[model samples]
Structure formats: C-alpha cells, structure tokens
Target: MAQDPPVSDLTDDQAALELQRLALVLSQANQAYHRDDSPSIDDASYDQLKRRNAQIEQRFPHLKRSDSPSDQVGAKPKEGFGKIRHRQPMLSLANAFEVQEVEDFVARLKKFLNLAPQSHMRMTAEPKIDGLSLSIRYEKGQLIHAVTRGDGETGEEVTANALTIADIPKTLSGAPDVLEVRGEVYMTHADFAALNATQEQAGQKPFSNPRNAAAGSLRQLDAQVTKARPLLFFAYAWGDLSEPLAPSQSEAVARLQALGFSTNPLFITCDTPEELVSHYGAVELARSDLGYDIDGMVYKVDDLALQARLGFRATTPRWAIAHKFPAELAWTELLGIDIQVGRTGALSPVARLNPVTVGGVVVSNATLHNEDYIAGRDSKGDSIRGGKDIRVGDWVQIYRAGDVIPKIADVDLSRRPVDSAPFDFAEKLKQEGIEGKRAPGDAVWRYCGDEPLADLAIEALKHFVSRQAFDIEGLGAKQIEQFYHRGWIRTPVDIFTLKSRFGPGQLQQLCNLDGWGEKSAQKLFDGIDAKRSIELHRLIFALGIRHVGEGAAKLLANRFVTWEALSEAMQSAAPGSAAAAALVEIEGVGEVMAQSVVEPFQDPERFAALQLLLAQLQVSPAPQIDSSTSPVAGKTVVFTGTLTQMTRAEAKARAETLGAKVSGSVSAKTDILVAGAGAGSKAKKATQLGIETLDEEGWIALIEGL
Candidate 1:
C-alpha cells in the first residue's frame, strides 16, 4: 500500500491538495453522522480530518476553498422532519484547550474591540453540557414550534416532540411577543441509565451515552415515544426576540428563568480571565456529580452590546468560546505514511496508525505535521522527541480532542523499527513517477508533472462554472468532473467553445452518453453559450484568485471598470509598488489580496490562459450603480446599534447599492456613521475620532434625493 509522506515532508502545494480531498470526505462524514444518524467514520478520525483542513487553511488562507468545510456549521436536515428556517443562525463557538489559550481568547476580544489589555471585560462562564441543541419558538406568549439546530441555518421542526417534554414550557407568562429560546436538551445520567435498563428489558438496543439517548428520544418520529423518554431542557440563550431580554449574558439567563424555563444553575459571571478560569475548574470538578455530562465550559462576553459589535466570522461567533478539557491520549502502532497530492501540486504526508481508542472514539490516523516533525523536530526545527525520529512499526502516542484532529505526540524509542530509514520525500515523489522541485526560500516541493497540472486546471474549471462566478446553469460540479475526466472540458476556455467544437452532428453526441439525453445536452450547450457575454465582476471572480472572494472581486471591478483596465493595473502593480498600494485603497482589499490578484496575472501560463478565456467571450465594463447622483457614493459609512425602521442587513445592503462603502468599524477615515438606538462604544468612538455621525432619520434624509 502507498503511504502518505510525513506532514513535515509536505510542500505548500501538496497541503492545499490534501485539504481539498479532506474537505469532501469530512463533509460527507458530517452528513452521515448528523443527518443520517449513521456515522461512517469514528469521531476521532473525523476530528482529525477537520483539524487538518483547518491547519492548511490557516497556513494558506489565499487557497481557502470556496466550498470549505470549515465554514459549514452542521449537516443538512434529514428528510423525515419538517424544515424550519431560523431567523438567526445558531452559530458554534471557538474552542480553547489551555488556560493560556483562554487568556489569549480574552486578549484577542480586547484587541478586536480596541480595548486596553488590562481593561476588565465582564464575561460569563457556564458548563457546556453534552446534549442536542434545541430551539423553541414562542409567539404571543404561546409556544408555536421547536426545532433542532440542523446546519445552523435551517433546522428540523420538532414541535410535536418538544411539547411532550415537560421542562419546555408550552406557554410563557412574561415572554417577548416573539421569542426563540435556544439551549441544550439533555438526559441526566440517572434518567439515561434507567432508560437503557428498560430498553434492555424490552429487547431494544440501548443508547451508548446520555447525549445519544436525549437526541434519539427527542428526534423520535412518534411524539408519544418522545413523551416516554426523560429529557430535560435548559434555556441559556435566545434566538429571535421581538424585544430585548436583558443587557448582559447573566441577566438574560435570569430573564429566561423568570419567563418559565429551566436554566442551568452552574452558569456564573466572571469579571476577569482569572475568574473565568476558576469557574471553569469548578464546573469541571463538579461535572461527574452534576448528574449530566459536560465536555467543557463556555465563556461569553457579558455585555450584550459588545456581543453585537463583535459579530461573527464565516462560522463561529467572535464573542464566545468553549474552553474544552485536554484531549485523551492512547498509544497506537505507527502503521505507515501515505502521500496525498493536492490540486495546488503540494505533496502532503499522512500517518496511518493501528486503530486505538482515544477519548471514547477509535482513532486510525493522526497528523505527523511535516518532515521536521517526522524527524523528531517541531515546526521551528527544535528537537521534541529527544531527537528520536518517528518510524513505521513504532509505538506512538495518539491524541483526540473535541473537533481537533488527532496528532502523534511522541514516539516510544524502545519500540523503534531496527531497519527503519529516514523517509526521503523527494525520492518518494520520483518513485511514484511524479516530478517536482523545491523552490528557493520555500520548504514545500511543487509538482512539475502533467497530471498534477491537469488537476489544478480541473479545479479552475469547477470554480469558473460555480454559482458565485460564471454560474453555468446546466453544468454542475458532477457534470464538470465527468467532462474533465473524459477530456471534454480541458480548460475554462474550452467550456465557452464546447457547442461550437462538438455540435449536434459530432461523431459522439452528448445525448449518446448514459446520463445525458438530447434535451439535456442541448440545455447544457445553451447554458454555456448564455455565459459568453458575462459581466466584468463575474469574470474576475471566476478566475478564482487567492483571497479574492465575490466582495473583493466587486471592489476590483468597481475600481478598474473594464478588463483592459484591470489587466493593466495588475501588470503594473508590483509588490510594494504604488500601483499595488492603489489597489489596497479600495475598501476591504488588503495587501495580501492585492498580491494574490497580481501574482497570478504575472505568471506566463496563467496569463496565456486568461488571454484565451478573454478571446472567447465578451467581458463588459463594471456598472457604476447610480454613484454620480447618490450622496453616499464613494463614502465610507458605518452602521451601528438597532434600527427600528430597517434591519442591520437591509441598511447595509441599501448603503452598498447606493455606491457607499459600508465598514464594520468606526475609524478616522469614516465619512459617516449611522447610529441607531442602543448605539454604544462604536458611536462614542466615532465622536472621539471626529467622524460625521447620523441617526436613522438623518441617514434616510441624506439618501432621500437618490
């Protein structure tokens, strides 16, 4: 069997390739585990893959895939349950393992909010109970529906099942007009044991854990079955509230309790990092005795206003983090290493280990980091394992933490393979009939082989046809993959010329294919033709340059206006050149992004490809969206607080449509700051910075002429 090279041996190109493969595998596994209720892989292995994906993204943010699994919240809802779209997505929190990590979390939050390092930021630390996340919606003081946190965006409606749980109040006394109480639905250890015992007596399969018992019971198709199960709900947070609950996290929990919902008593407020850590230890010590399982403790910014300002990332919230207990470790035999090629032509090493149980899950593989790590060195090339290299057939320490990839901690020198030799990454690539060379000033090797280049081209083609880019209606990912494998669509330019090259009278009609009929084939060709006269922004985004998302593309399009202008601008924009600095001036387009845009255009092969693509279509000039007539045009505006006239999203969208640059922070450069009700620190900061501030009516009046 072919072995993966050690992570230490991986080139940047190889890591990117492996990340793409892992993204697909882990997404499928998540689907099976969360939606189908059938786990194809053990939790440890799944966590390992997710961890690897995250590591690669962090190292190569520019190459972060569009369909990145890291940005995904949860699996899609199963078919049996009715779907309910949440007004606000139930986001997951970032994790911290050590006290230092917890401290770092607080420090990072302080920096984001522009607070001094020593400034006390009040926070709440609560036991993160191991349970299913449930959201119960109440309207007009009566419970309307309840749902599972399926994929965060939309969830499976379990209103019937929820009504059976006595702990979930059916009617609230003084609740908001519209309230979506979100929290954990868990089974106590005593309840779980009794249920399992009853199941054993009844000849049914018993649940493996209390969490599984609670989830399985609550998700029962029959409401009566759910009623029979003892499940408890703890309301800790609110989702869609028509009116404000409280000003702080602690007060909100108290409000939920007063409104007739069970709240976790362990939830406590901490004014400092030391208090947070102390409360976390207290929760951990009392975990086993609490009658319920808790994997960690969660810390949230107490001030609701701060939480609003912090907002969210692509997936997790910025205002909160879960400080999990350290991962469990177990010794496993190092089977062998495998080399996985990535789309970007980097060769990555993966460690295959004999199956071992860690943290109640089976781990079959762990990350070896890189060549240095395999050679018993850390990322900085410092000796970590007494200079003893990790070899095949050696006993290795494996670790698995929540949502963290399993990693090899140390090697047992006593059990090292006698005949083992240092793995040569370059030699291995040659042995596999792949040609690649390490670049100057870079540790990772880049593949020079034709097959790897083809893989890169195939990825580009997929992005070119993606919804956010070219958006070829009839040609989806599956169809593109099939076409590429069969040598039909070799390049993105080939896509535009498909119908012309392979007309109806061709020797092999698309209709002759097993999956394609005459009508479908015609539709595919028509879809390809419809995209010939694409907008400048779409073409720029379709290029799939690193760090260049749709927003960045739009910014570039607005600045450059035409294909020629953009091409000239990129060609002239050398790193640290005034031309590059000009590109960065465009709101939201940073230096890293500007460099990615220019570097690809500078490559001869990529330049040739772009020329070919440009020749095959009509690229239009970027439209100026009524900029000349709008007062907000070319202005940097910040919207803060709550707007009763319109939502934060609606206001932002409107501002952008009127050619205004909507910024998240209040800086000295801000032309206008729109302050709504509850306007807090950002409003104060705007005043301190001497930036123009406007209320909702003032903003509306300014834009009324447009």
Candidate 2:
C-alpha cells in the first residue's frame, strides 16, 4: 500500500490539483450512497476523503471550489421511488469525530443557551443505527403514508413497504391527530444473515451490507418482497405534530413508546456531558452484542424549548450532533491534483488518488483545501506534516469515518518520488485576470476573477427566479443561463420585457433553439408573463440583497407593509439616522443586516435596476388578515412575557392565521394584550391605557370560538 502525502510535502500547485480531484470523487461517492445505496467506497474511506477535503479547503481557503463536497447534503433522490416532499425537511446531523469534538459540541450547546459552566444541562443519547431512514406519517391516529429521507427536502414514498413492517403501528391509541414518526427501518443481524443465505441459495446477488439489505428491502417495488424480509422500525423521533406529546426530548421518546411504536431502549437521559460520553463508550463496547447495527451515538439537548431556541443551520440542527467512532485508515498513491471554479469564484483543489480500499470502500479522490494547506502549513501558519508539503506521485495516508469524505492523514516520506515538484495554482491557470486573494476574515486564497460583478450576475438571476423568489415556472437554471448568454435576460426587468420587445419573432427564434419546441417556447413566455404580479416579500428576496434572506425579507415587508414604503425608507435612511434605526427595529433585523439592506439601495446602478423592475411589474402589499366575525379579527394583539402553551413564534403564527394582527409594542392601537407570566412594562402600559389584557387561559378562551 502506498503512503499518503503530507500537506507540508506538497507545493501550492499540487494541493490545488488534489482538491479538485477530491471534489469529483466525493461527489460520485455521495451519489452512489444516497441514490444507488451501493457505495463504491466504505464509510472509513469516505470520511477520510471528507476530512482531507476539509483540511485542504481550510489551508487553501481562497481556492475553494464551488462544487466542494462540503457544501452539499445527501445525494439526489432516485426516480424509481415516488417523490414525497417533507412538511419539515429531514435534515442530517453534524458529526463529531473525536472525544474532544463531542465535548466541544456540548460546550457549544451550553454557550448557545447561555448556561453557566456548571449548569445541569440534560441531554439524550441514542445509538445512531445504520439503516434506512423512514418517515411514517399518521393522520387521525392512523398510518397515512411512509417515505424515505432522500435529500432532506424530498423523499421517495414507500407506504406499501412500510406497512409490511411489524414494529410500525398501523394506528395509534393516544397519539396526536397529525403525527410524523421518523425512525430507522432495519433488519436484525440474524435476519440479515438468513436472508443473505437464502439469496445465495437462490443464486441471486446478495446485499453488500446490512444497511443496504434493509434499504433495498424497504424500497422494493413489490410489497410482497418487502414482507418476506424481516424488517423492523425503531421510532426515535417525531415530526410535524399537531399537538405536543411531551416537553422534553427524553419524554417525547417515552411518548413514542407509549403510542405502540418500538423505541430504542438503549437511549438514556443524562444530565451532564460526562454521562453522555460515558454512555457512548459503553454503547460502543456493547456494539457486538446489539441485535442491530449502529454506526455511532447521537446526543441531543433534552429540553425541547432550548432546542427550539438553538434553531438550525442550513442542513443540520444546532441541538444535536452525531459522535462517530474512530475512523479507519489506508494508504494510496497520489496520482494527480485538479481545480474547479465555484459560484462565488473560488478555485478549489482536489486530489486524485490511485484506487485503494479503506474501511470497505474504494477512495479515488480527496480535497486539498487551498494554497497554505498544500504548502504543509495550517491556515494559521502552524507547521503540518512537520512542515512537509504533499506532491504528486507521493504515497499518502487516508482515513474515513461514517459517510464523511476521505482525508489525507499524512504522507510517508520514505515513499515520496524524488523527482516530484511543488504545485503553483496561478501558473496552472495561466490567466493574468485570475489572481489569488483571500476574502475578508478568510484564511483561504481564492482565485478571484477581475470582474466579480459580472460573475455574480448569473448566480443572482438564478436566485431571482427560484421558487421562493419570482417563482417563474419553466424558467430553470439552464434556460436562464442560455438566455443570459444570448443577451435576452441580463437583468430581472429583461425577463418581464422578453415578449414585448422580442415578441413572436424571438419566440420563433427560441423555438428554433436546440432544446425548445413551439410548446416549450410558449410555455417559457407564459411563465415570464404569469410573474407580472408578485408578493412583496418574494420581490424583496428576489433582489438578492446581501444578508436579506427569505425570513429577513418577510420581516422587512411586514414592517413596511408596501414595496414603495420600504424603497422610500431605504432611499432616505442614511447610516446611523433615525430611518436606519427604524429599519433595525424591525424584528430579526440587526445592524449588519440593516446595513446589508441599505447599502444595495445606496448603489445607483442597483437602485436604477430596482426602479426598472418595479416599472415592469405590480408588487403586492404584505399579508393582511380580516375576519369580520371573530372578535380579535383585524384587532391588533400584543403578546408579552413568556408563552406557556406554545412558543411566542407559534402564538404569533396562530394569531395571524386567525386574521389577527400581531404587534410588538403595547399602545392605544393594541386592542388586546395576551399577557403570560412575568409581564412587565408592556402589561402595565396596556392596563394604563385600559387595553383589554388577558392571561394565557383568557387569551385561549377569546380565540376558541374564532
């Protein structure tokens, strides 16, 4: 086996090349695992690749590729399974590879909740079983459907196969009217062995692993085939609940048990991080004895309220993390390095490795991060590989943990080829316009183009027409790219004017395009025409202002009520002015976000673009609910202090649904004040103004009829 090259051993050019290769290989592996369920590489190999990819990315931060594996989630869903969109995305958990990382996870959670160092924070630890993820939804206490966790947002419907499992409950005795029980569908070791034996006897291809066997069985087209397989479900979590089952994570698991579903018994509640880690060790020790397979232990914050406050990242929850066991390592030869450009103009490097198996999977690539990583120094300039740089043709050590990308651990000095040289990314690209530079506060060296604004135009347009934005159907990324290249859709306004300026002549030209027919061309024009009118929040989001995400845009829209009002405010709001303060006062808007919202409007070119866009469309005002029959309908309600029955956000959402206007302040306009415990000056002001004040119970009573 060839040894892995150390970062110190490689030059900048070599590192960039390695990162590029790693990106391609990891992407392929992810697809194989998520879509095909037949991973070409083992868990250990994949982890090593990912770790190496991350390492290189960190070292050469500027050269990070757009298609860097770190940015992606699970693979795309297969077409065979009927696509079912999840009500709430089924997100993946962040991983903690080391004991220290687990400790850091706990510490981070504690800090997020503003807990004292000695705070008796409780956590629930459970075995992360290696099986197919299943979501069984129940309506009116009866099983309605089941689906696979495809790419978090959408999954394949496997209702029939799920019904065949004995451990899944067909009907719940005392469950919420609407419940989504998410868990793993797995076959026991004994059953898997027997099934494989039977398959071998029948001269059929046996499953590669227990996880594969379970996934394949549950995803079978014929329900009878799934029934023949001894599959069992261990309900571990609940989603999209109509009502609360319990207040904490541990109690929720108990509720799942009481509701006639099989819950994992090994999961235990611990008040401290020590206990969680200790329990993890015990579980790891007993892995051989467990009936089913578990790759690692998962630790989640016990308090549901805290979990809610911690919220979520782009793809993982802040309250939970999976602590994977030690990864396996193998050696492979460094064949070459490559680079690829990202949407943000970062040039990322990847490693192409000679085929080598590690932890049951073959790894052919890994990530090399950026300039410094390939130079054998940490992002902070600390010596790595004893200050040795990795070079092409050198042997390298690779490691993998779970489904993470494989990483190069170190290079074996003895096996490095004598004639190998350092890599220079700038020289490789050979373009004066493409220069390497670091982003603000970023340690990586990105290969930035001279004209970043032009590069940003294409990505900006893509976001502008996305579902959450303009939602122009039939105008997908490919179509937008083509139109941009053809000078037909350079800006948002161009999309609206396509028919008026170009008309049938352009439509005929579009029809003559390779991928377009008469029907498709008409459909494209119709899509553009249908979006002549748009909601205020969507329009604000479509502008793609920095830090102005969907949520932030909604807040701005609701606060201002109309596009004209917001544009006027932004136009007049000088930095540190009262207008700027008002913009910041809106819920969820802070100084940074307020500045991001303002700076774009200050730009003459962007402001003109906005004007042109407005001239070509009719933007609607923010949502207004009016229910004439309801007492609180159209009435301004202010919720103060802690809400006992539900979260404050939930209360506000419910109130809005009932056609009531929820306000942040208590004043003469506040018709009703829903005061919970510990109500302060707002409650006093409401009382002073003779505004109707109601406790949690009273408020519930008032809304009961409505």
Candidate 3:
C-alpha cells in the first residue's frame, strides 16, 4: 500500500481516491475483526488507517465518499447465525491520539452547545476494553435477546450463549420495560492463558490474543462450547431504553450495576481535560496490572441530557472520544526507498527497512510521507530529524503508532555510513521512469497524463454502485471496471439501462460475454433493476457530488423532503441569495459544502446528465420524522434572548426533536418567534415579518404536551 500524504496536502481528486481506498480497506478490516473474530491488522495500524481516513474526509468534505469508513461500524453478521436487528445502533466512539485532541473534543462540545468558556461541564473517563462488544436487551424486566455487535444496525443472535456467561444477568429487576445493556465481553489474562493451555493440550489451535479468544468463545454456535469458556461482561452503556437510565453517565453506570449488571469500577467523572488526561495516564500505567486487556480511555459527556443535545455523527457520538495509548517505538536500518504510485497517480516514497521487531510486529516498510519528509523537512520546509536527511544504509529510529506503516522518528547520525549521501527524491523518481511535476501549492508530484482521469471515472462509477449507494449486487468494482473498458456502462444512468441495451437480440448482449453466462447476466440485470428505485439519500450519495457525503446527503434529503424540492432549491440558490443562505443553514452544510452542492445544478452539462439520470429511476422522498402530535413540527424556529425556562441549547434540541428547524437568524421564512425577557433584533424582525409571536411561558406551554 502507498503512504498517504497529510490531509492538508491532498488535492480534491486525490482525496476522493484516498476515501475509496480507505472505504474498501476498512470495510474488509471490519469484517475480519468484528464478524470473523480474526483481525488481519494490529490495533495500532487499524486505528491509524481509520484516523487518516477521517482526517482526509474532514479536510476535503466535498470529496467524501458514500462508503466512507467514518460512517461505518463493525461488519455484517457472520453466516450460520440468526440475525437480530438492534433497535438502536451500537455506535463506535471517535478517537483522540493525543491529550490535545481530548481538549479539542471538549472544545467542540462547548462550541456546539453554545456554552460559555467558563460554563461547568463534566465528562466520565473509563477504560476502553479491548474485547468484543455485546448488547443484551431486556423487556419487562426479563432478558429478551443477547446479540453481538455485528454491524451497527444488526447483530448475530447469541441469547443462548449469553446465558452461559456468569457475569451477564439472565434477567433484570426493576429495570425499564425496554433496556439494552451494551458492554464489552472480555477474558481476563489468567483465563486466556489457561484457555490457551487447555486448547494446546486438547490438540486444538490456540487463540492469538485475549480479545480474539473472548470473541471466538462468545460467538460459538454451540451453547455448550461457550458455557465452558470463561467470559466476563462489563456494562458501560445502554441502547433502546423505554425510560431514561439516569441524569448523568456516571449515574447510569451505577443504575446498570443496581439492575444486576457488572460495571467497571474505575469509571469516574472528570471536570476538565487535564483530569481526563491524568485518568488516562493512570489507566495506562495500570493496564498490565489489570487482569483484562484495555486499549485506551474513553471520555464521554457525563450529563445524559447534554449527550442527547450533542447527538451523534454518522457512526459515532459527538459527545465522546477514546483517548488511545501511545505507540511503541524501535530502531532499524534503512535498506532502501521505493516509490509507489497511488490510484490518483501521486508518487509516494516508502522506506524499505531491515526486518526488525517494533511492538512485537515484524516491520519491513515505513511511510516516508513525501519528498520534503525524505529531505528531513516538513511541507513548510521546516527542519525535521534535526535537519539530517535520510540516506541508504543509515540507522534510523522508527515508531509504530496506530498504523502498520512505521515512520522514521529520528536519524542515528553517529551510526550513519561515512560514504553515504542524502538521497535525492526527484532523481530517484526520474530513475524509476516516472515523469511528473508538483503543481504550485501542492505537495504531491502527480503523473502528468490523462490516465488518472480515466481511473477517476471508473472509480466514480464504482462508487455509484457501492454498497451504501445504489448497492447493485453482482455489479461490483471488478464488473464496473470490465464494463467501463467494454464500453457497456459509461455513466450511472447507463447502469439502469443495461438490461435494455445488453438484453437478448441486442447488438451487444451481456449474456454473450465470454465469462458472463445467461443466469449470471440475468442476475446482474435483476440487480440493476432492483436499484431503479432508490431512497433520496442514496440517490444523492450516488451522484458523487463533492462534499455531499452519506451524512450530508441524508441531511439534505431530510431538509428538502423530495428530489424535485431539492433540485429547485439548489437551482434557485444563487451566490449571496437567501436560498443560498438557507442551503448553508442546513446543519453540517457550510458555505464551501453548500457551494459544492449547488455547483451541479448550475452546470449545464452536469444538470442535463442529472435530468437524464432522474429519468431512469424513481427517488423516494426522505424519511419523515414522526412528529404528528407536535404542532410546531416541520416549522422554522428562531430563538433570541435569555429564556427563563430552559437554556438556549436545550430549547434548540427540544425543537429539533419535535421536527422544527432551528435557525440562528430571523427571516421571512420564520414560522414563529418566542420572545424572552431580553429579546432583541430577532424578535423584532419576526414581529415585523408578521410571524406568530409567543412569550417564553407560552412557548413552553405550546410544546409541553406529547
């Protein structure tokens, strides 16, 4: 695999390619780790890839792919097990590699909630168990189902196996009518060692690690097999609750304990980032001493209400982050440097190192990052590695962090070969017969050819039929590439028209192809036909518009309701116009993203293609929020001034839950305004616009009833 450049250094096209690669890689990694109970990559490497993917998506929002890794959790349930769809998705947490990132997480929360810097906030810090995630649901104080966190939305039914675990309660006393306790199922060090010993004595293959052992044991098809395995569960969170667990996260954990579930004893509340970091350090220091394996510390907003207000991203909670432990480091000799071309044609330098052990993993290659990095400088031309450039046969200090790709941390100048000289990256590229030039303001030297554009087109088509998009089964990436080269499928619309164009008696029939037989070709056509009607969000994502990722697509779909409405809104949204303002106001869609969303509608060629595509398919309207009982549902609301009843953040969150669109500024579109004691310009504007007005007390009364 080629080394990824910094998120800031990637061009839009490069970012899109990176997203596609990450999506594919991470999806496979997830299936291996979560569903198969076998991880192909180490934790550090997996985390690094996930982090890099997220950073790239963040930097190039418009180029975010529909199958982005950030929006996915776990993998599909393994075969041979009955599937159970979770009422609430078992979401993964965002990660923080550094203490500063924890601070940033806290800062983002405050900013999102419109909280003052001095406002009091609390977060709960707890050890992140390195084990399988399990969700045990209880109904009417009785255990109904126990499932593995297969994919976020669905899982493998393991109720019979769960009954064998002593730590897991068979039933709950005085619990909510519906409660889903989510936690980690782990094996202690002693148990793992004993289990491995038993396996070896029984002439069976021993497990690789405690986490894997626990997962394999818990997921066994035979309940008797699982009953013999020593397993423990620690409840940390809940899903699909009929009633609130508690006022805060810490209290919720206690509630779980009271309800006959085991909870981690180290879980505690912290008031500041410093305190959280201190707890992380304490946990890291105690990791070896603890019987169970722990990878990091998880920090979440303590207040349950605040967490609800903060809400969730596509696959992670906005109110929480996992602070991972530091990476392991080692030294190695730089044998050679190899340049690999990426999907977008950028030449990336990879350092070939002597096979050395780093954190118990054999390392042979490391990411050189770019030419600047190889020259012992950063992108801004600042000195790195003490201004000593790397050379062949030089001893270097390497660190394996959250990536399988180790990186050179420092040069052992004292041990450098006297005859060695600084390796010229440009000269090496030339010697490799790669001709390219680095564009101004770009760090990467991309291939100066039209081949990359063709690659991009194929990639775009692949994304169009991706699992998260149209999800046309039997038409995978390989098929897409083959079809592209064969001139059978050129565009998304062409995919829907395949049956018509390549059916029986046509000049070119898919069934006539060497590899594709009648049944397979018919199945392919059926797959294409099955996707002729797609949901609004999936269709928007299938368009592959810059900045309009799956999450953003869903937001737009929900906001506009229908395809025609969205098309009209974007087409009418001129620069600096009120329509543009409204487009940007859709939460998570800012100015740059808003511009990207409008560009397709403005472009003559793109707009015509879009119309043609629409003609080939039926796009269902966005899923409507069930707020039929609320009078303010689907209304635009603005809040200004000091409310006596609730905080502004609470008010906004409440309104949104009732299907009201909350806006910062008052406009002609404002449906109603709630005037508080210190109501200002917004209130006046609302009154002038003839929008319905109400007092703070009246506002509370209007939304009080169910």
- TM-score per candidate, in order? 0.48, 0.47, 0.49
Candidate 3 residues 1-706, lDDT tens each?
2454567776664565556556766888899899988888878778888988878877888888777887888999999899999999999988889878888889889999999876769999999988999999899988888999888999999999999999998877899999999999999877988998777533245787788899999999999999999999999999999999889999989999998888998999989888999988887766656777778899999998999999988899999999887675677899999887654457788899997755434578999988888888888889987898988999988876533467889998899988998888778878976777888877787677534455656878978988789988688777787788988888888888777775446534565665567677778788788888999989988888866777778778877889999999999999989999998876667898999899989999889989999998988997664688788998998877656446665577567867888888888888988765445577667768899987665688898866
The CA lDDT of each predicted structure is 0.80, 0.80, 0.82
Q: List the residue pairs that clash in candidate 3.
A: 44-402, 45-403, 61-547, 62-546, 62-547
Ranked candidates (TM-score, high to low):
3, 1, 2
Q: Any runs in candidate 2 off by more than 4 Å, and if so which?
A: 1-16, 59-61, 327-706
Error of 3 at 149 (Å): 1.2
lDDT of 2 by residue, 1-706 (tens): 0244765565564565566667767888887887788887866577778888777888888878888887777777888778989999898888888888888888888888888878888899999988888899999988999988887888889999899899998888888999999999987877888998777433245776678889889888899999999998899997799998899999999999999988888999999888988999898776656877787899999999999999998778999999886665777899988765544456677889998755444579988887678879897889888888888898999976555677888999899888888877667566434566767666555655555544457877888998799888678666777889888888889999887888677778887876578777678778888899999989989988867777777777777879889888999899878999888766567897888789768889878988898998999998754556667778899998666466675577557656788999987888999877446678779879999887766788887755
What CA RMSD would candidate 2 show? 18.5
- Model 2 scores a TM of 0.47
Off by over 4 Å in 1: 1-9, 38-48, 328-706
Give a tens-digit lDDT track for model 1, residues 227-299.
9999999989989989999989899999999988899888888889999999888766555467787777899
On a 0 to 1 TM-score scale, where does candidate 1 land against the true structure? 0.48
